[model samples]
Target chain A: MILDVDFHSGVPIYRQIVRQVQRLILSGILGEGHQMESVRDLSGRLKVNPMTISKAYSILESEGLLQRRRGIGLFVAPLAESRKASQSKALFDALLSDVAAAAVQMDVDLPQIISGLTEHYQKIHSQKEK
Target chain B: MILDVDFHSGVPIYRQIVRQVQRLILSGILGEGHQMESVRDLSGRLKVNPMTISKAYSILESEGLLQRRRGIGLFVAPLAESRKASQSKALFDALLSDVAAAAVQMDVDLPQIISGLTEHYQKIHSQKEK
Candidate 1:
């Protein structure tokens, strides 16, 4: 639902939109069966071209994460939530490797990273409770 | 030095190459002042276009992570390792937000995520020790 696009990122605008939509769906912010913004409306709101938004929607549909009805707009697919678990795991593994590799390079030892992560987790958890 | 390109990914080949090189630098596998593989050689090895490899190297140079000698080959910048601290923090933050969002969406509680991370950390730490 919160889609912010940086046009200067060198990444294609349509691709950014597609990834953001996928993220929203995976995050449960856009749950299963949730309708997506109409291409024209989203394009207007985001100040992007309708074709770009439509391109993103078409890709998501092809991925089976979004479904379209004849007269209705696009919506999240029923199986998207279930599929997200594995997707999230893969993403998490990639990020962890990235961070761990950096820490090792910087001589930030494993115990330090573990302690840092533990502290970060507690902080986020406490804030969520509040 | 390990660069694996997934042609099927929506991400461009050049961009993936750039990220992998950056990751290698951050991990200290490619240390400061370390020369990189020649464009022709790397392209041949990866079975990718030389232009694509050149594009990645050019972007990295612009980012101040790579240096090109007039007659010699490309080398990792002297300051790249020091500069990577801030870069890694930003990357870590982005990844944390992504994972946290997914967990929240799935109704996976913070404590569960914390425990999972702790377990993962310990496992990786033990493996490294071995």
Candidate 2:
């Protein structure tokens, strides 16, 4: 869809597309069994190459976000939410690894970052409910 | 440093390196003028390509998170906080655009996503303080 994508960010275009699809699914904008535009159709709409659109869809499909429906079209999959959980898990793993590396490079300890993370995470979690 | 790098992540190694350095500076562990190990040293330690380590530093330097000190070593730049701010802004922009696209595809209006974002954002913000 026309999200006015920024082609100049540090993030890759495919990733941008992936994130958009994820948000759509999570926000219930795109629900299970909902048909998505053909990659070519979306490419024409967004003015991006079919490869990029396919790349986005393919990555999401691998992650269980999109499902191939034999001959109809790309349908929003039922596992979208679970896929999101996995995606977030992947990100969290990256974040923690990065934090651990920082701990070592800065000659600090992991406990410090974990302590801060726990404290800040709690604060943020509590805030999310309000 | 020994952050136990994951080679299988969808995220590039350079970015993982950059994120670690960022966390270090933001947390005040690696203060201004803190000398980082030579790319070779880090590469040897991590068993990664030296080019990858340098690539990470180069990316961070361009973002103003690190400064190339002539003949000494890579020093943690004072602009780390500002750089962090910029990074977060970039991420926010991506998130917004993605959400917007989801709004369009689901045939939901942008206002719904914005309203939800605002509500959730405020709730999270308020909780963060506590």
Candidate 3:
């Protein structure tokens, strides 16, 4: 999976890999039980140190997003719905508060944000043909 | 805004913050223009290094999710729909591929992942009431 990083940004490389990958998993784009790039492979692809990739994978594993097998490669964890809910709720709280503040600052009403989000959500649904 | 780190897990702390927060914004739980806690405040709250918080915020800001306002603390950037679309798409690509691979590996079919994701997506939509 691609880490999707903007290397020019001040954010460190390793964290970028972690964040982008995590985003993929949580968004339902990465389904349960997938194999991520081997750390060595990703390191080669990103031209970064293996430690960096290893670090990212380790994080995903700990979040229960990735599972490790003795001889097999690192694979996506299976069915993380229940595991992610609590953590996701806390993250959402911060995000919602931030967005609310931004909307207020921009003189945009809450309804506007809600509408835009609803539109996007519907778009995703329709695109998925669900 | 909390970083939502799992210190015991293998992922680095700052990266955890970035991923979780990013998820919040994308999920519509965090609306546009939201104000995250100042780096100093967050650093203090999490008892982590100022550098860590700074690093995470810098990534978000670069992604156009957060804006650095001089002396006003780091505020959430204004709505960034156009900019985020490209970046978010790439992240989702990796996520979907991973999930698909995982489903195949687990002897599960695409239908299962799609169904689960669909069910969860529906739950989110209904909860939002839109």
Candidate 4:
């Protein structure tokens, strides 16, 4: 249920919402049947337009990542384990590719990049534990 | 001299141009004093509005990444080596932090992420060598 969006990032608010929600679901942080925050509540919290939130939810629903139950709300869909694994792998691979390309373009050596990654992993892991 | 913009990515075209140019300069691919492509020519090549390309160049110039050479054209500025090193570290670290967070959230183990990074690095390095 935690989402962050950078208004100045030039990326559309709706797309940011969609991407974060997709990440959460694909990561299994929001497992099957997890109820999504209502459009109104999420818009209020995110300070985004209600329509934008609705648009993001609609996209997720259409993508079969979320399902709507009448009079209730949207929930994460029961995606097959295999499908989730493949999707996560693809998403992570794309991210890793970007990181690798950027590191090389920035003249960062392999050992330095590896150490940096390890540092970040430990830092984030510790933060999560707290 | 190579830049790409994803028009459908929701990120602004000018920002994309700025980021790519910055990457090129920081990587030393576009060395100090290297002339930048004229705005008109680059716009024509990228099929983006000349104004958008101009805006990107202007911003880079203000950031001291590009300099105007009287009536010639924009050229990469002679940034101090230490400054470049620090800036590159900061940029790469930010990217690494994001990647690490995503990997942890996606339940990817350290070894898998490391191998993925190594594979991408080798793939990109070979491509560049080719």
Best by lDDT: 4
DockQ each: 0.26, 0.11, 0.06, 0.72
After the best TM-score superposition of candidate 3, give how far the Cα of residue B76 lies from its true spot, in angstroms. Answer: 1.6
Off by over 4 Å in 3: A1-130, B1-3, B115-130
Q: Mark the regions of model 4 whose C-alpha exceeds 4 Å error after superposition.
A: A6-10, A44-50
Each prediction's TM-score versus the true structure: 0.69, 0.55, 0.44, 0.90
**Deviation in angstroms for A13 in model 4?**
3.7
Model 1 spans > 4 angstroms off: A26-32, A80-130, B80-84, B91-94, B97-130
Chain B TM-score per candidate, please: 0.80, 0.60, 0.71, 0.92
Worst ten in a row by lDDT for model 4 chain A? A101-110
How does model 4 score on DockQ? Answer: 0.72
Provide the lDDT at A122 for model 3: 45
lDDT (10s digit) by residue, model 4, range B1-130 = 7687889976789998998888888878899999999999999999999999999999999999999988999999999989987877787888898899887776677888999999999899788777
TM-score of chain A of 2: 0.60
Report the Cα lDDT for residue A10, model 2.
64
Ranking by TM-score: 4, 1, 2, 3
TM-score of 3: 0.44
Clashes of 4: 0
Model 2 pairs in collision: A127-B123, A127-B124, A127-B127
C-alpha lDDT of residue B89 in model 1? 61
Best by TM-score: 4
Model 1 agreement with the true structure over A1-130: per-residue lDDT tens digits? 5576878978899987887787667656688889999999999988999999999999999988899986999999877445687775655555556555444434456565655665565565566567
When 3 and 4 are scored with TM-score, the better candidate is 4
